[model samples]
Target chain A: MIQRPITVLMLSGLVLILLIGVTPAAAHGVEITYALTPVQTVRVEVIVHDLAGEPVRKADVTVFTPEVAPGDAPAAAEAELSPWLETSTDRNGWVSFVPDPALAGSWQIAVAVDDADAHITLPLAEESGLIRLASDQGISVMSSGLQVTVAATPITTIQVALHAQFDTGEAMDEAQVVVYAPDNPQDPFLTGTCDAEGRYAFAVDLGRPGVWEIQVRKAGHGDWLKIDLDENAIEFEEVPVDTAGDADSTNTTVQTVRLADEVARSVESDDGLSSGQIVLMSATTIWGFVGTALYFSRRRAATRPESESDN
Target chain B: MPRRFVTLVLIVLLLSSALIALAQAATGTLEFYANGEDFVRQGFVSKDGWAISFDHVYVNLTGITAYQSDPPYEPADEDAELVFDVEAILEGSYLVDLAEGDEDADPLLVGEVDAPEGFYNALSWEMVPVEDEESDMDGYTLLIIGTAEKDGEVIDFTLGIEQSYTYTCGEYVGDERKGILEADDYADLEMTFHFDHVFGDGELPPDDGLNETAPGFAPFAALAEDGVLVTDLAALEEQLSEDDWTLLVDILPTLGHVGEGHCHATLLDDVGETAE
Candidate 1:
């Protein structure tokens, strides 16, 4: 009986040895990790090793972004990945993948090695802002060949004066002029060119209160001006003008004084005038007269010399 | 259990032994042979209708061990004047009587054997006329005799003869003359000379410049058999126009010369076609 038991033990030992001899050694699975950046790309690296810590070769590997719940599988899982983005390691047993236009926000990456699996979650962020646009001087003209202005006060009624002069410095009869309000540039508040003496004037009614831009354009030349208006604000508060002088001798002074007054009045009124508008109007009136006078004077002078020579 | 293990080991050993024995039982063998001596003969009719024969005969004995005489020629005694000195004999020739085969067959004569002197140590039999007309049916025959002995004395020997014949005639066209102008109705004409080398030499002579009084050697210059000079320009013009003689004549000078040593001629129906 004892011999039988001994034989059974020996048989059992032999069976154990055979099973152990056939058993396969454990294989170390690969672990892959990824880092992503906006405007750049995400990089994935795979590391493979055997149970003995020796690098293994010919290990089939694949990597891709995982699908989300209740949705179709990600396209990347089914498509051929870019060569630069997908790479297998040389005999050394290392592989890497980089996502072009790196994924934004959270992304899950899955990596498989010789049937084993592993994954990593990557968080990507986009770099912040880079572009802007604004006006240079507080006010700008629209495309209609006119002037515009922002204002602090409401402009109720605005009056523009007229004056004229011939090339010989002699005053003339009539002139044409055109003026435009910011609200309606196509329809001018005033229209006409300078008359024989080169002078013009007009007035406009402010429909409502707010910043208004006035535009002054020479008829034939298409030259124009734009000015911001804040009716509640003061204009000539910055300029010192001499208001005492004979209107005739002071014409030059008056021109300057009137411009200053307009500016002040425009600013003080419910619809304040833009400093730019006051300046442009004053300059236009004065220069219009001066240009006409200079032109005629030179013409007369040139004719006189020719006539004299003919005589 | 131990007995069972021992029995299993014996079974594997026996199986392997059987497998080895089976592998050794299969066997195979291979063999090879060299080509034998060969020869061929051909015949053709010349453009001028003369019977011509071309014989290309060779002996291949790299592996043959013996040889024998062909056709009418039997082995001659050692003292015979025309005894074939195999050591000195490289080639041989014979003539066939073509008339025996058909009444209309042209006569074929063996004129001579032109072989390099000293190449062969013996002079074979004279040109014997074979009585076999059946043999001449094809206008040619090849006969080979010799033993292809590599390292031993010559043994069994026999002769092989292959005969062939081509009924078409062989013709030669000469170079054409350029820049010949004639009246519109007087189309240019060309003369072609044709002959067969089997007629021996001097059948045709060199060409002399036009207008020369000497009789020209051109075939068209003289009628075959009669040797009459064709000098009538009107008749020549009529023949030329009938055969588009102008074209043929123009291309005659450009056909250059054909055949080595011998000359022949052909009249082209259209010289322009020939030139193109």
Candidate 2:
């Protein structure tokens, strides 16, 4: 569905997560000490406005609290979620609702101003006593772009995993992959195809440090990612960090961010894929590091993102 | 050509052919649609008691692109940051009449594209003036020719809106989920325009948000001249009062939706009549 600009209604509020523990019952050599974890509730102040910054008066405001606390959300099925409270913004566009204070995470808030509608996310911090979350766990600069083999390990040489997935939750398996060095944008640097997983792997010759471009194209659709490699390390440039497609197709979310961080740590602590080859390429006297090993560190890839994500 | 050069050319050709084959194997077709809903087809009474029926509702669309997202794009998320790599784009401009079929007609099909197989959850569309000033729809993005009758009096009306809008949305939110394509399979997405939001549904309460925001056919009927009215938003703005003009402009952006879902719409200032 197209989104109504109701997002002009900015929701800001003070929030806290609370966990209440019931006293354990002990009777004649038996002990019941299980702690009951309730959902979280945080107070919020919602201010609805039009794009012109004028407060929208008498608008209907409703908030949908998360049915389960963070880390406790059901893996597969969505529980029956319902509206927490139904209220109206005052003349000043000021309206506040305290959720039953149960779940600790993000809550959904909707406002119907005049006839236009808006839906906003009310962020609840993790510290707000949100039902003491279960343990949860991504890589170095490791989100949706290539890695320079610099963030984690100390090797000059590196490997890149270029991922091509434009639609939400789906892989661009077998996409056409092409590489272009900064020196020649018109001619091809390297030509190849992605594996069945929409990923193309290649070793970045950091020894030949220069800005490199990788393009993943399929059917008439394609995108470009820019990689800058210098003496300090590899830095991603002009890469889109957000996405356009958000369908529930993959049933899994790729943690591109921190993927690099994780890879870096792994190299420092020795985790994930095995490290490979150290070729001694003839070096230029000014910048000579011919013996730096090339290890297979994974990288994230994306180029075009939706305009909405730009903000 | 020398043997070394000839051998290199052969290798390049073979590699290109292999990549093309791989792309074909991973692709499918995705279709795009536009729907004016029952208000434009079956016709409905405006909240002000005007019976309105459309003979033609032409909308021009362009820049249609579809994409797959990792976290699943929620068009409703205000602060969402979207990321995507490859995506399907339906290039060129297209014009479709929402009143082409009968009352129970299916949504109008705009076009289709060969896309990589993925769960395409997000889409974008734009409405611009038809090309060439000589054409009937030229210089106008939206054209509505309809009839409205109230209290035994009939008025033939032609409402031409020069305003343009770009609607980017996430997912289809109707009976069944759409835009899920498998290799060799076909999927579809829809761009829905809720005319009721502009005319107001008489079935709904007078106090309803849609009705309150809509200017209703009553305002247009009052602007009718000798049982026939053909005018644009500029003329209407001058003829209608300040409150009515504001109400109409506010309602215009609310016209587009995705199967009961909302879209993020931007009124293009550089195109058409250059609306304020």
Local distance difference test, each candidate = 0.26, 0.57
Candidate 1, chain A: TM-score against the reference: 0.21
**Where does the lowest 10-residue lDDT sum fall in candidate 1 chain A?**
A16-25
Model 2 alpha-carbon drift over 4 Å, by segment? A1-311, B1-24, B77-82, B271-276
For model 1, residues A60-114, the per-residue Cα lDDT tens digits are: 4433332221111233445633111223334765544332222234334433446
Give residue B159's lDDT in candidate 1 (0 to 100). 22
Residues A33-103, candidate 2, lDDT per residue (tens digit)?
11111122333556666665677677766555554343322221135233444567678876654343334
* Global CA lDDT computed for model 1: 0.26
Candidate 1 - CAPRI tier? Answer: incorrect
Name the runs in model 1 displaced over 4 angstroms.
A1-42, A65-86, A127-311, B1-276
